[model samples]
Target: MSPEAGTGSPIGGTLPRPRSPATRDLGMRASLLFPDREVAERYYLPLIYTACRTCYSELEPQEIFDRATSGRVTTDKQQDLIRRVIESGHGSTIEHIVFTFAISGVTRTLSHQLVRHRAGVAFDQQSQRYLDYKRPSYMVPGTIADAPVEVRERYLAEMDESLAFYGEMLEAGIPGEDARFVMPNATRTNLIMTANLRSLIHMSGLRLCTMAQWEIRRLFQLIRHEIFTVSPFLGSFLAPKCVPLGYCDEDRNRDEHCPIRPHKDNVLAAWAEKRAAAKAKGREVPTL
Candidate 1:
């Protein structure tokens, strides 16, 4: 059975789509390559702390770094300063330290979205052009894989045939670059990504949102977990933007379908009502 014949849903519905359970392992992996918890705990906080302290202290930057790195400043004191600076929106302080991750087995679809984050992040992706794929593998969406037996088999067969044709093209003296055109978005790929803490948090905010694509959202979920394993304090900041903003700003989410955060429109409407009431009583409400 063709997938088109199976579902009557519109292509771009405003309502959130029902996501299949993420129980199936898509073989996605995101491993932190730098700064294990101890390193992060020892230097990351101090680095940011030094950056923050250098602003207020008359001392040189190196002196601040030395004091923060050495036992001159206590951990509690360093963390307190770092936390205050971060909360006050001094993002550059956090940018002094970076985290690297070795990500593998993600589909090209996810990689394309991941690379859209251009600020403070660097990516080194596995080159499809340089290496001939002797055994190409691809990801299957959970929804497609959990379809009716016939539908599932059809999907699998199509992927198999595409790869087989790719192999046939290679045998016929076709260049790998040209043969790779047949590869679908599901084609698995690997990448090495490096991003500062600030950028990581920013990326997490968007990708962790309920409105994000299911696969990419899952990827961020894995990333957040990895960060949490190393530093829960830093990991605590890796949440949906709405989680921090206290309101959902997404246009499609105006219907309040996703309950993670209240719709911004509703919040504004409620505030307007309160202001109207206050105005009627001849009292001006002070705007924040």
Candidate 2:
């Protein structure tokens, strides 16, 4: 009997489930392609230092950059000033240096979400309209792959049928652009992503959150690992925003399901209680 036909079994009546933690290999890759560690260590920090120090120093930008790169200003001093400037919300200082990544094998679903970040970042994605895929690849979510054997086989068969139909369309003199209309969100693609340090940090803050979609969250994890390999100092800044803010702001996290940080509402409620106690003691407490 066809799996889709009711078989009077409990599994046949089950609803589709969310993606699970069944450890399916996603085959995603994020490689840092520009500014190796030595180059980044020598020039990247100096560049940002020049941008920041220009506000406080009489020296020309060139002079400051030369001083920073030539070690007239120690690395410690440069990093110290850069850290202070960044923590002070002076993001323009960090916008001077950029990192480039060669990202591959990610699903269209992940790429769609990734390209939503527009500020200080650029992307060149593989064009389905231009490249006629002779043998297209795709991703399968863990939940689908780990479902009951009959259900899993049925899902695979559907994916195979879709791709086969796409190929048949291409062979029947259909344009690649039109043929690609049949591709699923699981279709894999590549891209080149470039972003300034500030934008990378901002992107990471949201993508690295526990509440983020698993695939994109994993992609950011790889991105963070790549950054850490080159410059741990810069990578240190790539973390969930709540780590710095001390409270999670995600609406879905109000129930505190993923406890990477306390929910903002709970934190505010605690603060209100503290303030009430202080007011009762005739000592006024400052509001956050």
Candidate 3:
């Protein structure tokens, strides 16, 4: 359960928006499509340079893109300078380098957590209303599937019942939107996501949190896997939110378990302890 959204509760009226479930690249590759390594190595930095410069310089956007994409500007220099600004949280520079993933086999439950990102990311999911599936499927979590055989059977039975009901609802001339009310959280879907580096980091932070739902966390695992395929350097940035933030803010982490990173409270406590120790030496630590 995601404490961020009040215990990963049923999305219900809280998330009124409907989205297409994307599921094209689950076990598949996100690399075989747009912005191949050649393009990324060549025009990517320049394209970003153009985007960043357009807002500041008198030159036209295409001219900037040309300067960056063409041999007029060097790629390493552009990337090096962009890294500094990105580190400083000057996010606009990253809006230029968008990665599109051919995402597949994720559930509607995960998608709700996904589309909450409002800035610098765009998603187009496959429509449920139009996709009259010959065979609609759902996922079974390992915990549930690995349960007692009868329990697993009961779980799958519920999923099958839900899918069967969805089809029956459609046959009864029910609207897809309302008919989808019968769909299980396990229903598989696909999407294509284009996110700037900043939003990508932000989403990775939340979804990668130990307290986040397993489905969304697994989706990020897939995203990281996809990123790793293209460039390990870039993939290095895709990690649990705490890896970059230096502390875990997820409320569920107050237990101090999941020790990949220290809880934010523990960090504060350590700082306080260190500050008291410094005061014993008659030197007070200055507030930032």
Candidate 4:
């Protein structure tokens, strides 16, 4: 495991770094569709293991992967190569390892943001027109879920009404394609997303941000859990943007309510303070 995986501790540990209350574990059955655990250990890591090795070794990448996966090369050597390549930000090597997910029970609103990633990923969403859901379900946001009974009842009623209207339209001889237009953003969806290691990290950085929509953020939380089940080392990369960046950059984080990490503004402020102190002592801080 990497020593520097999770975000660091703040002044008071009381602040909640808790995972989203809206998220739940549906298991890795939804996430590990591309390479199984044994396959990943035997081939995927070794593929990246080879990619990293080829940069330094006299041998070719194909040769390296063959040896590494076949147990000719030691696991330590493979991991050491992977570690250096990753730390140096040679992302192409890590891109060789991909993950396939059978994402289910997430909202259409979440799926919209997920599919926006145009690089190193592919997605095939369940067609609302073709797959007329016999039993549709929806996820209520934590804020709404915790609301008073009257408010919660009203919210659920509105969602029910929207789905009812879609069914009614379909029953009234409207085509499924046209009927789907009445479906609300609250409606659940399923998808198959296959993303390379680098893309997964990039997507996790964005979706796990405090600025991201709550529903999509929750989906990422679930996805991360699935990855953790198979491989903690690989799964550790799927953390919030601030965790990897060492500071939060979201515009809304200026107020610092989230408190997972110090905001970028805080880091800059500390740097400026140190510079001023140095200037007072007749020393100059070097500029980039």
Candidate 5:
């Protein structure tokens, strides 16, 4: 693993970091399709602030929104309130706003995992049943790409043969849907995904984790970059689950292979030690 693979930590601890792969071209792209900088800057925050403020304010939502968007409520104050609300786990407040993306050339492997996020997100993928693929493209994992000549060649040959046979089946009058059965998980696909801010945060939490599959992690990185271009404040929330939780929770992280954060088990053990010391001093320690 590269020594500089993970982001700098605000928390006080060191752990193993995995070597994150570079996405670089890789025949895939994810572009933010809605809320350009102007819209994001002018409305997205205010929209979310309104949602948060509505819970406590006696004023009508429109009045709150007008106050927020028209600058009567300073952006700093709105952001402070919104940030606090979000950190407090008021998820429904953030769900009032959404982001849409134009995703293309990702593998069926990735699309399968992505569409699994059902709540507060919608996905429309290219249909093999409807669109007849002419020259299908596919992904080669770095392992395969860097394999020995004979191994790499065999992998490519098998993929090429599978795609070619699918084409032949199409020519022989097999339905595209049936022929698509021959397509490998590596076959590239496209999708349009729209997700509410809460869902996006939740999805990013999982997909940005080192434990996540590399392709999906890279996809979220691209998605995060796109969000940063428009709104860095909101973009900051799209991070590994451990980032928000303050400790890694994945059972696999017990060995500390991907040291983005201290594992939850370790954190709890330390907390218990502190509690025991406090008890020894005849003091009460708060429970987590």
Candidate 6:
């Protein structure tokens, strides 16, 4: 649980709409393949609400789940409790639910970063070692695509040459495990990732930020959309870290150029001013 969660403040109050990049058709996709909308609507909330309710209720877990799922507890009440428990930094309550995504056509560069998250998450990626490529496609970043004609042409030609050589190596009886050494980071791959709610929110906080790599940020954007389609309430929790922190912490944003939130320095400066004013009035305020 984040320190900000202990404040019991709703971080999703006004999440800036994620930027819609022009990379939509670039062969990338994130589909929530499990826990479809019906399941999410019927079981997900009840499960989380039951977990939260179990903490302070005398009712048995089974009875609580039954009441929640049977509509004995109204949806609004369940959501309200969930919102409060989550905002109260009781993260384990929400870990009972999980989401699985079928992610495809992202670059190796992005997949490398994606798999680094190890807690409360599981992933099985397409194996480059077992599969042989036939007309394998690669990604051309917006920067490279929009470069001068000669630079763009050279980039494409280099990619084509690399794949052509990979094919020749395979035909010459090189194992894919050995031949994939030539595959550029731009080569596309697929993965199936399942993460509990807590881990999903944590990953989203890091990956959905403006300071994140553009391709991976776009991937999380697509993932956030998938979560939104199934349950907007759950999706609301997916946001950049600064949203929850109520200030930006990235050193790159020290200049406060991104504007999503004030820098931590500025927030602390304001806090100090308030504290000093209270002291001058012969009163003291609690320290952060």
lDDT by residue (tens digit), candidate 1, 1-288 = 111222323333233334632444677888998879999878887788888898999999898888888879988898788777877778998899898999988889999999999999999999989878888888767656556667657777898788888889989999999999998788888999999999998999999998889888888888888888888878888999898788999999999988998999999999899999999999978877
- For TM-score, candidate 1 versus 6, the one ahead is 6
- Which has the greatest lDDT? 5
Candidate 1: C-alpha lDDT: 0.83
Pairs of residues clashing in candidate 1: none
Cα lDDT computed for each candidate against the true fold: 0.83, 0.85, 0.69, 0.75, 0.86, 0.85
TM value for model 5: 0.91
Predicted candidate 2 versus true structure: per-residue lDDT over 1-288, tens digit per residue: 112211222333344544432234567789999879998998998999999999998889999989999999999999899999988889999999999999998889999999999999999999999998888877766555545779867876886787788899989999999999888888888999999999999999999987788889888889998989989988999999898788999999999988889999999999889889989999977755
List TM-score per model, in order.
0.89, 0.90, 0.76, 0.84, 0.91, 0.91
lDDT of 5 at 55: 88
What's the lDDT for candidate 3?
0.69
lDDT-wise, the better of 2 and 3 is 2
Q: Would you give me the overall lDDT of model 5?
A: 0.86
Name the 10 consecutive residues with the lowest summed lDDT in model 6: 1-10
Model 3 TM-score is: 0.76
lDDT string, candidate 6, 1-288, tens digits: 000101122232232333444333566889999889999999999999999999999999999999999999999999999999987889999889999999988889999999999999999999999999876778876555545667666877888888888999999999999998988898888999999999999999999988998889988899899999999999999999899878999999999988999999999899889889999999957765
Steric clash pairs (candidate 4) = none
Off by over 4 Å in 5: 1-18, 285-288
lDDT of 4 by residue, 1-288 (tens): 011111222222232333663443321125677677787777777888877878788987778778988889888777777777776779998888788899877778778888999999999999988877656666665445545667656877887887788778878888888988877786777899999989988899998787787667777777787778767777888888888678999888899988989999999999899999999999967889
User: Residue pairs in steric clash, candidate 2?
Assistant: none
